[model samples]
Target: MLNKVLIIGRLTSDPTLRYLPSGTKVVEFGLAYNRRYTVGEQQREESHFFDVKAYGKMAEGLGARLSKGYMVIVEGRLVQDRWTDKDGKAQSRVRILAESIRVINKPRTEEAPEELSEEIPSEEVPPEGPFDMEDEIPF
Candidate 1:
């Protein structure tokens, strides 16, 4: 069986970081994704909101970096929490248990400082010159 999910979305609000009694770090945040589609000559846009959680080093790292309106890529699995409410009715909701997160863009706020909005390097660009077989690759 395979249980994996990948989503690219913007943060709905600042991340909340906390620690359990055992001192394990945990971070929770809300993510919003937009979907656009055309149906019978009409265009429609839909937005989805999700609750995301991360643990340990990843959670600690994101706790300091993530904020409202920051675009990010979340890779993780789905989790469902089930319980009975005060009304004696069962309640459940699904959320993402983030294993990894990548910030793809800065926050939309104009007041963000240039340094704070600096792009996080995603991948190293190859050299401009043509590759030479004899040249050693810097792996």
Candidate 2:
């Protein structure tokens, strides 16, 4: 059976990066997608929240860049996690296992200036320093 999904949405919270006992990195985050529809003369809007998980390279690469309010497109498969609670009741939830993530938009402050160096005076331009989170360098 085919079980793939593609979703574009805003992150509801910053992604949490953690290492499993086996030393594998994993990232988890929440996504919110809005749906708008019209039925006859009525207009309606609703938001759907989803839990997403990414592993290994994808996790390490995106963990720091993903924050609340960031917009991204995720491609993945649906998974169901099942476990027994402390009270012995069974619990299960379907979540997304992200295979890839594409950042659609960065926040205003995080976005780089669009103008070329010639557009601004040399004195007014900010000085460049050591590469930080915004840099494309791999971790």
Candidate 3:
């Protein structure tokens, strides 16, 4: 069985970070994604919302770096939390358990430099150089 999910979306609100009784770090946030489609010569847009969670180091990092309106790419798996409600009814909802996350864009703010909004982290960027067929492929 395979349970993998990948999504790119904007954060709906600032991430909330917490720690479990065992001292495990956790973060939770909401993500919104937009979908565009054409129907009968008309263009329509739809939005989807999802609850996302991350654990440990990933959770701590994301909690500090992410904010409302930040665009991010999340890779993880689907998780369904099940429990009993107050009325003795069974309830369940699905959410993403993020394994990794990457910030693609940051929301414009007065305190931030304009150029920094779209800049990718130096470590994730490839070195600039002319392509050479003779060079061995890093991959």
Candidate 4:
């Protein structure tokens, strides 16, 4: 069987990082995906929240940079966790174990409204330059 999942959403809060007894790094966070649909003659919207986790390098990177309202794309698989409660009843939780994540939105800057700086000028490269393709095997 093959299992895979991909989701893009905004983070609900900052990621929490922890370490297991085995010294494995783990990061957990929540994501919110909005859904839009049409009902009768009006437009309706809703959000689906999901719990996510990353391990090792992925976990460490996300825990260091991700924050609330940041958009991210995650690729992973569904994982189910079970544990016994104080009363001896079993509880189960479903989450996504992230294999990779790409940040889509950056955190807001701390600068004041009038402190924003204009973007620096970048060197412009001219495209469509003439080149010979047959003699270009450099590798």
Candidate 5:
């Protein structure tokens, strides 16, 4: 069985870095993911919110570089947090335990002015069409 999860989305809020009593570093943030799909002739889109956290050195690095609205790629595994609620009932929720994080977009400081358009080479963009499932991914 596999439990790995990979997600690319925008940060809904700035990352918060904290230190545990044991001196372990951790960072937590919210991510907003959007998906678009075609149902028959109708196109539909939806947004999903996720709670994500990173630990140790990765958390320190991400906390310094990431901010609200930044696009990032997170690779990790799902963890179920189980505990007793205030009502004394058992509760559980799933969250991502980030093993790695990569910033997808350029940092805000280096971005060109909004009025300027950056032209990307045609080859840089993937063509829109059907794909063979058996084909090896270029990446």
Candidate 6:
């Protein structure tokens, strides 16, 4: 049996980055996913929130750049933790242990294209020439 999950959604808020006692970096974020379905007569939509966590370098880079409304793709496994609450009730939460994350889309803005230009010899552009097809039938 395989246990894996993939999700594509927008960040609900900026990722929070923290470190453990041994300085192990961890980042936590929530994703807002929406799905549309048709009911008996009308169309309906619902939004779901998923908790995600990234570790080490992935956590550091993702935490710095990810912000609210950013779209991302996450792949990971499921993890659940159980604990007792103040009411003497057992509470459990399932979170994702993200193995990898990739940005899916960028919001529209007036930003220039990122050009990675390298120094190269510039050649003169060739002049345009008119096409001549007079030979016979000028259709």
TM-score of each: 0.76, 0.76, 0.78, 0.74, 0.74, 0.73
The list of candidate 2 runs beyond 4 A from truth reads: 108-139
lDDT of each: 0.73, 0.70, 0.73, 0.68, 0.70, 0.68
Candidate 4, overall lDDT? 0.68
Give stretches of model 1 more than 4 Å off.
Answer: 109-139
For residues 1-96, write the lDDT of model 3, one tens digit per residue. Answer: 788889999899999998766676768899999999999999999999999977777777777777998888887778766656777788877878
Selected candidate, larger lDDT, 4 vs 5? 5
Q: Residue-wise lDDT of candidate 6 within 13-98, one digit each (tens)? A: 88999875556666789998999999999999999999987667777877776688777778777766555677778777787778
Between prediction 1 and prediction 2, the one with superior lDDT is 1
Cα lDDT, model 2, residue 71 = 77
User: What is every candidate's alpha-carbon RMSD to the true fold?
Assistant: 14.7, 13.5, 13.9, 16.5, 13.7, 24.0
| Candidate 5 lDDT by residue in tens digits, 32-62 | 8999999999999999999997767777777
Error of 3 at 107 (Å): 1.4
TM-score of 2: 0.76
* Overall local distance difference test of candidate 1: 0.73
Predicted structure with the largest TM-score when compared to the true one: 3
Quality of model 5 by C-alpha lDDT: 0.70
- lDDT per residue as tens, model 4, 79-99: 666656777777877777776
Off by over 4 Å in 6: 107-139
Q: How far is candidate 5 from the true structure (C-alpha RMSD, Å)?
A: 13.7
* TM-score of candidate 5 against the unseen true structure: 0.74
Predicted structure 2: clash tally: 0
Supply the global lDDT for candidate 2: 0.70
Q: Pick the candidate with the highest lDDT.
A: 1
Error of 5 at 57 (Å): 0.9
